[model samples]
Structures are given as C-alpha cells and as structure tokens.
Target: MTEHQALRIRRFSTDSAPVGERFDAWAAHSTYCDMVTTYRSDLPFDAHRDNVSIGPLILAGRTWRHPDPSLAYDAKRTPARIRADQRDFHSFSLQICGTAALRSDASTAVKRAGDLYLLDFARPFERVITPGSEISLSVPRDWLPADTGKLHGASLTRGVGSLFGDYLMSLYNTLPQLTRHDVPHIVRATTELLKASLHPELDTLAAAQTPIRDLLLQRIRRYIDDHLLQPDLTPGSICRDVGLSRAMLYRLFESAGGVMREIRQKRLYRVHQVLSSPDRPEERIRDVAWRHGFTDEKYFYRIFKAEFGHTPRETVEQVRHRRETGTN
Candidate 1:
C-alpha cells in the first residue's frame, strides 16, 4: 500500500460570543486578514465556527446565523496583505446553504445553494454574505495549469454542472477517507477539473495532445465516476460516452494502474461508504455491492477484503457496533 499523509484540520469558533468582537479574531486565524466583515446590527450576533484546512488545497466550511455580512477587500489592503502573506490563490466558493452576492472586476452575480463562483484574492472584490453555510476551495495560482484571470469573477454553476461539480463535491465528501498520499492525486484532479470547467472547449484537444494530458485523464475519470453505479458501465461504454477509443482510454489510465482498477477503486469506496454510515447500519453488504455494480458475490467478497483489509461483513458489523456504542 502507498503511504500518504493525513489531512490536517484547524477549527475555530467565536466561543459563544454574542457580538462580532471575538469573530474578528477567529476569522483572522481561520483565513486571511485582507478583508473585513460588517455584521448586521439588527440581528443578534450568533456564534460561528470555521473548519479550515490546507491539505494540499484549502478547504473551509463555515456556518453562521448572523445577517449577511458586508465584506470588502480593496487595493490598498490587498497589496499589503499579498506582500505580507506572499501567496497568490483563488477562492472557489460553493454556496451550500445561503443567499449571497459577489462583485469583482470581471462580473457580479447573485448566488444560492448549489451555485459556485470564483474570486481572485489578489484583486479588489466585495461580497454580501447572508446567514448561511458554505464550503470553499482556496487554490494556489501555480497549482492551476490554466490562466486564473479568465475564471476570476466567473460563476461556475453552469460550467461545473456536469462532471466538475460532482467531482469536486465527491472529493469534499471523501475527505475523511483520504490520506496524505492521496493529496497529490486529489490536487491534480482538482486542478484539471477546474481548468475543464473554465474551458470545456479545450477538452477535445486536451486528450490528443501532451500539453494537457492530466486534464484529459481527469475528464475520463469524471465520466467513470458519473457512471459508477451503472451495471453496464464498462471501458467500451466509457469510451463511447467520452468520444475516446479503447486504446486512448487505456493509455490515459495506464499510469494509475489501469481503467478497470480505477473503476473498482471507486466502486469499492462507495460500498465502504454504505457500510460505514451509522444511519444505514441495517443495509446489507451484499446488496450494497450489487448496487454499486458488483455482480459476483464471491468475487466482491474477496476484493472487498483485499482492498480494505477487512471483510464486507466485518465492516457492516463494525458500523452497527459503533452506532450501538455511540462511537465512531
């Protein structure tokens, strides 16, 4: 098994403060200091918590009940903050459960749950964030292969609707299962999906050419992910859907072992999820496997044990045990 680093998480809270005093301090440590937020005086200030991390890429989830805060980051503050931090990054925010509006040099848009947009931290931007929840990614400029300028201020809801959004959300969902060794691949996939979302026209050329092979591979992986639960999902089906030949598909996934290996990996992971969920303690392991496209029970049992070093039955038992014992 390949050794990977564990995801590092840092959490912050206002400590139940009824005002924005402690919030200012918490926000500083949670993210950056170039911007300021003005909380609404009409609503009672409620406590807020931010779970933040930079595990290869920045992932932050924030929850608050206060009124939409007016946020601003200007030229003077941005320059000084950039000089101080010396880091150039773009923020892609997904409004998980909220109403908000963002304005930047390129565009302005209203956003709600299921909508995602990008903001260049180095530029002058302002946003009015309503009481809600959101998950955001802070990606470094160097990490992205494509130009970030084109993505700045662009709402990615439509561009990312197909595979990009699903891939990103899947990554976020699997954070608990990821290891440090997983960071490199995750980051690379994230970068590629971002590029594809910003410029889908390049996907065709991306595969045939060497300049963006990673992006092409990410595209193929996305397609496989979207069809993972289909019983007829196969290499041929994937090639047809992605407009690639079997030879090209094989060549792309060759480095990661093979196309079948990738599909199996994704399938096994999904099965693990069903078995692990405490709420689904009564779910049958065999049924879970079949739902994820595993047709052979004996083969599924053997591979499940090999892949996770534990039997499917054992995993379900453990989940039930955890639920009964109130443990994780």
Candidate 2:
C-alpha cells in the first residue's frame, strides 16, 4: 500500500469549509464517532489534525490551540446509538503539549501535560481544552482489563509521578514503529499498565480479586475462569452469576469481543495448556478437548487451529516428540 493508503488520516479545518460545517465534520469523524463540538462565534477558529490507525485502535494527535474555547460532547452514544454503531471503544486524552479543563459527571479537573484521563463515549460528557495540543488513544474497552466504569471521569495526572505518564508519551511518539501484527500485543500491555497506574494496590493477584459488587474487573475475570468449563457459559449466565446488569456486563467485556468470546478464549487457552503438558501424557487430544467442554470434535479442531495457529494433534505430537528427545 502507498503511504497515503496505508495511513487513514482525515483533516478538517475552517479554511476548507464553513466554520460550523467544518467543526461538525471534525467532531463526527476525527477520533471516535457520535460527538458534537461547539465553539464561540466571536473568536476565530483553526483546527488541524494527524491520526494513525493501528488495527482497531486510533491514535490522533490534534491541535486544540484555537482562539475560542470549545466543548466537545459525547451525547449521541445513547443505548440505541451504541447498538447502531456496534463499536465498543474508549479514548484516553493524554496532554502531550498543554493543559485542558475536563468536566464529566463524576469529576472535573485541569488535565495538564503528562496527565491522562478517560474519555467515555458511551456516556454523555464534555471537555474544554485550552490553547494546546493533545494526543488521544482510542482503544477497545475490553482490551483494558479493568472495570471501565471506575475510570469514567477519572484522571491520573502525571501518573502521580510514575513512569506511566512517560510510557504513554513514548507510545504516542513511537506509533510509526508498530505494525498491524504488533497492535494487539501493544494494546494489551498498554491496557495492563493503564490499569496498574489507576490502582497501584492491584500489584498482586490476591489484591486484584476484590468483590464484584464493587465492579472489580479482576474478580469478574476470576469468576469467568472458575466457570469456563460449564457448557452454559453465556452472557446471561455470567451476568446472573456476577449480579451485574446486561449493559454493565457488556461494557465490562466489550473490548474482549464480549463475554462469549472471552469464554472461548479461556477454553482454548486451557486446551493449549493440556496439549503442551507432560502431565497429560496419558490423555488423548480428543479427551482433553472434551474435558475442556468442547463436544464437537470438528468445531474444536477448527477453532483450536484458528486460535493457536496449529492443530490439536500437531501440538500433542510436538509435545511428545520434545518429551522423548529431552528437548523443551
């Protein structure tokens, strides 16, 4: 692909179109959709942009330096709109250059350079950035392994003097070095770091498993793992078991491709572990698959290969060959 085709960058400015139409277009298509921006009529307006998309994630470093202060509202993400959009993502505004005043239903603060704040598109909120530029990362919410609700309207200014602030800045600076193949792994690590920065006490697995009523994501993850072997592990089952509403459950696992996808992933991971273990020398591949609640041999083979890039029999043969040769 040509450089232009490889990068999906859309630019909007008052010089190209009428001011009202220009701002409206930028708000709709700039980063996340379902947003509306308003500016004062008396002041001059000038907005420029550069955005890069790595797989499902969007990194946009835009110029918020205009004469008039503006408010960007995420009002169109109602339940019906969310269903219509069919996209589960969140944006983190990292103040790369200057500060911006943020106002959400939960809190309000000045998000300065090195500060990172959650931008929830599913809920209604507005932000007023001063004359400066900021880079925002639009990430899949499920990719983040934390109760996103807890992060709504929250800010980690300079990550409380941690390297997380610098880490995010480095991510933005090094976007060109990442390829589509590397996006998923990069996103996962970034999410884990972001979660850790939010809750430092989340350093240990034991501390991570707080009550689900508190909307602790690790506990919900643990619950999912404990019940992954059950044949009836549906979204409804998870919601009922965890005492979370359907919407909340959906939100919790949105970036994970929803709860059903998560269950399949866990099952596939377990199957891979069994296939690779010497402790399972007596177990046949089919028996291991069945033990992991995979009843259809054909479907299991298909998804297993897709998930691991190798067949179950191939994995088992490799394990046996390695064991016999004393090679790991």
Candidate 3:
C-alpha cells in the first residue's frame, strides 16, 4: 500500500474548554491535512470525549472509550467546511460502536452503528458527531471508475434492509477480527459494497442503453442550460466536473440520441419556459429566446418548431391568447 494518508485524528479526552476553543483546536489540525480548509464549530459542547478523523480511503482509526463530558458538535451559527487535499478521493464513514448525529455538506443526517455517512471531500462542509460512538470509515478514490458522470453529486446512501447496506455493516463489524493478510480482500469488498450502495441502477443498465442513459443525459442537458453563457462551458469542462471520460460520457447519452441533441432539447425547453411567462407579458418572444442561449430569432423559430411542433411566435401567441380568453 502507498503511504497511509494522514486522516487527521483529534481526541479531546480531558479538555475542558468552551466550543470556540474546540473550534480553534480542530482548525489547527486542518492545516496539517490539505483535504479540508474551513472549519465551523456548531453546537456548544465545552467538554466531551470526542475524536474526529479526516482523510481519504480511511479517515477513522480510533475508538472513544468511556472518557466523556457530553460528546457532540452542531454548527448553530457556523457550518463545517473542508477542502480536498487530494482531488479524486471521497469518504464513507460508518459507525460501529454506537449511533451518531451527523450533519455533512448537504444535510443533517443520523447514522447508527452499521450505517455510513458519505462525505464529499471536494466541497466545503461540516459533520457533527455525538460522543461515545465508534466509527469505521472508508475512502477509496482509487477504486472509482474513470467515467463518473452518472455518479457526480449522486445521493450518498442506500438505507438498511439493502444488500449494500448489509455488506457495509458486515465488513465493519468483522474488520477487527481480520488479520493484516486479510486486509486487501476486506478492503476490496468494502469498496464494492460502497459503490453498489451509491449506484445500484447504474450497475444494472450499464451495458444496454436504458433510462439510466436518459437520466444522466437529461441531467447533463439541464446543467448545460443553467450555465449556457459561461465561457468555460464545453464537453471537456463538463466531463471534468462530473468525473466522466469522453467515450463513457457519450455512452451515457446514447439512448437520448447524443450529447448535442440533448443540449438542443434543453435549449428548446428553456425557450418555452421564458415565452410562457405570464408575469412578463410585455417581453417579446425573440428577446425571451435570446435571453436563454437562443441568439438568432430565425434559427430559434426553426428549432422550436422542429422540437416542439410549434413556432416560437405561435407558442407565445397561444399562451397569451389563452390567458386573455380564460381558456388556459
């Protein structure tokens, strides 16, 4: 194995400082690890036996014994933030000893023993862990596939009573019993289960062109429209952010007729949205289309008819007429 990435670990066993002091203490460690930058201290817990870990592929190492004051952190006024020391790695933290109240990048979630919290390292975020809980975390960036468009910002979990969730719990519960010789196999299994938890549908329909194809196609199409005017908008830029390669990226949209078609479809959808705006009755159809990546009125009209079976002006006229005639 490569050198163990220092998943920064801090244990405040006997510290009796206020929450601000705790914030500074954790912030000091952030400098040592490059993956995280901003640190926000939530919840006022002055004293409690707490241990927090941050790193890639494996962020957890210690278990908190019965050395407690009251264990927990909740960012009331402040939220947790971190920068990825490494670009590709992501994290999945599982509680083995007890349950924890976790608030990660997007939401406030609770994870009990056998349940894992997936944290996006690339984004700035914070997590609040309740005291007296033992955790086993897995970070396996190296295991992720090259084409990850379908996986970017995908929801981070499969709940219990599922195969992946069961595997995660089984792996964590049995890791202590496995010897060093067995680490590789256990780690491999853990990684597989983690991916499965996050991408069950992708696994099933990867070979055949399916709705998984359109889901990603539609999502990417929407993403392009939202950032249509950005100068940096391009296939290369989209691939980088979503973690997909060019070929696999094409495959994801194969069922949707290809990337360009999806983009055109999305642009038409945006055109329709603006033209049907009843609140802006004074706005002309040409100006509305131009405002949303449609610069040429003639070209926009042709494409609008080709895609929606109605000319841009006709659609707007229908909408306006309906509203005026009480037929809408």
Q: What TM-score fits each model?
A: 0.55, 0.48, 0.39
Per-residue lDDT, model 2, residue 8, is 47
lDDT against the true structure, each candidate: 0.68, 0.65, 0.51
Cα lDDT of model 2 by residue, 1-328, tens digit: 4322334455555556675576566565544344544655554456677777766777777775554444432323445555666666777777876566666675677777667778777765556556677877777877665587568767766433244565456556545434454455555555556666666653622232232223235435766787888778787876665555588677777877887787778899998997888767687778888888888999999999998899999998898899899999
TM-score of 3: 0.39
Best by TM-score: 1
Q: Assess the local accuracy of residue 247 in candidate 1 as a C-alpha lDDT between 0 and 100.
A: 80
Clashing pairs in 1: 4-181, 5-180, 5-181
The worst-scoring run of ten residues by lDDT in candidate 2 lies at 204-213
Over all chains combined, what TM-score does candidate 1 have?
0.55
* Tens-digit per-residue lDDT, 1-328, candidate 3: 4332222335453244554565455444333132223333454423322233222245343343333424554322132323224444565555655445544445565666655455445554444444445444546555765443344333344542144444444333433333343444444454555555555556632422333243334445545766765646667876655444677678776877877676667667877877777656677677777666667788888888987888878877888798899885
Superposed model 2: Cα runs more than 4 Å off: 1-15, 18-21, 28-44, 67-86, 158-162, 201-328
Which runs of model 1 end up more than 4 angstroms from their true locations?
A: 1-5, 16-20, 33-44, 47-55, 66-77, 160-162, 202-328
List, residue by residue over 35-114, the lDDT tens digit for candidate 1.
Answer: 36544365444545544354457877766665445532221225566666666788887777766667666566777788
Ranking by lDDT: 1, 2, 3
Instruction: Report the error of model 3 at residue 296, Å.
Output: 3.4
Which residue ranges in model 3 land beyond 4 Å of their true spot?
1-222, 225-232
* lDDT of the structure predicted as candidate 3: 0.51
